[model samples]
Target: MSLQFDIDAVLDRLATDGWVVIPHAMPAALTAELRDACLQVWQQGLFHEAATGRGDGQARRAEIRSDSVLWLDKVATLPAVAAYNAAMDDIMQAVNRGLYLGLAELESHFAVYPEGAFYKKHLDRFRDDDARTLTTVFYLNEAWPQDAGGEIRLYLDADCTQHIDVTPEAGTLVLFLSDRFWHEVLPATQQRLSVTGWYRRRGGSVPW
Candidate 1:
């Protein structure tokens, strides 16, 4: 099934607040299939420890981040993965039309956070690169309990004085300005699953 969301509402929210979270952005069937595919790759030990920075600066820093990741192909053979790509493409076009963001492409990955894993606060865009225009994270953990513990903490102010915690629930999609938000993942008590990605403009910098 195709993904569904309100473009007007999402655009309005982004313009007003710089970020928005949509519950049930994807259908249940699609969410389940994508979750299955993610688990299949994870069980096969295909994911690698997530690293920070780009190129020579890139290195695994367990002190800052402890999750694993498996990037998705731009054109995926898996039906569920293909559907997700299409959905994101739709969103990219809508955003460009509404906000004139000039978004041209998306790079995404399946991320798994093991028990007690966390990522420290950081901006999605690198200091040297500005191609990343928007950040999107789609959660696939079904029936997430209140105590699951892995929540994206979005810092709302430059001084980090205000914030919001977003639960990683199935079929939920969160979007925000890549260069604007300072966010982190709280340590999880159990495994956490999601697809994380960024939309890029035509010519700011190469992707890491």
Candidate 2:
């Protein structure tokens, strides 16, 4: 069955549950292209191990690189990524009540985790700043297994306790409030590939 994109419904759900999962926001071919692009970057030795200092003795790994305007521009030239971005813009606009007027700055990055690699509990938004209002994660694995781990666990409270875990599914788009939500990625049994970034309001920006 084909998937539907419902911005209002998703925003409502996110407001209530602190997150929302929208299936197939991208086409299969486009997803493959983005995945390949990320892999190319990884193979070229462009990524580094992600920093982990906020956890309580939990093992994890992640690599983050910014300056995605060029990367996103390249991907946007492709029909699929462009279409997905357009749809995403609409959803983001709806979520922010149209505060996203004018061109939206899109930041993109490739997150890869090999076996036993994971990201501990953390928040996407900066403590001293609140410009990043929305965050999006696009899964690129073709058939991600639930048991393979690398699922994102979003905390419901300030102490990082009580939460919901989400499996990384290809063609699936997950969006949430960046500043208010706390989350983490579990270690993966196999390599996990994904593109994650945020849509901001262009003020009080924090480079990360």
Candidate 3:
């Protein structure tokens, strides 16, 4: 099916469920470009396992290298990425109403989790940083399955008790309020690739 870019419908669902999936929001060709970019970065030996040096960081068995602003500089400037970002901007505007300004940073992340690699439950946004309002994730795998195991589980409450599980499907775009939700990337029985990032409101920067 062709991707549908329904900003209002998606925003409405996000407000209610704390998360929404815009299936195939990305074009097949763009998805291929992103996948190729991620693979190229991997070949350059720039990938590394995500290490937080804390007990809470043990779930992810894959590697992660940041500095996406640089990686996306080349990709985002491409006609395909520019068009996608424009669509995302429209969605952001619909959510924030007339207060939408501009993106603080566009992070390009490549996640490669082999079988058993997973990210434990965590929130993308910190309580101290309110500038980060929206988090977006794009799947790169072509034909992900329901049992693929690399799904994102998003908490639906403040207590992190109730939750919803989202399968990682190619060309799928998932977005939600960054700070208001807690989520995790489950272990995959096979290799998984994706580009995940956030759109922030104008604000002072936070130390990572």
Model 1 lDDT at residue 110: 95
Clashing pairs in 3: 48-63, 49-63
Clashes of each: 0, 1, 2
Global lDDT scores for all candidate models:
0.93, 0.68, 0.69
lDDT by residue (85-141, candidate 1, tens digit) is: 998999999999999999999999999999999999999998889999899999999
lDDT of 2 by residue, 19-67 (tens): 7878887768778877777777677776756543323432234343211
Q: What is every candidate's alpha-carbon RMSD to the true fold?
A: 1.4, 5.7, 4.9
Tally clashing residue pairs in candidate 2.
1
Shift of residue 84 alpha carbon in model 1, Å: 0.3
What would the TM-scores of all predictions be?
0.96, 0.76, 0.77
Top-TM-score structure, candidate number:
1
C-alpha displacement of 174 in model 3, angstroms?
0.9
Off by over 4 Å in 3: 1-3, 53-86, 98-105, 205-208
Give the worst 10-residue stretch by lDDT in candidate 1.
1-10
> What value of lDDT does candidate 1 attain over all alpha carbons?
0.93
* TM-score order of candidates, top first: 1, 3, 2
Tens digits of lDDT, candidate 3, 15-125: 667678888887788888777777776777767666533334434333432222223545555555566666666666666773343545555456666567777777776
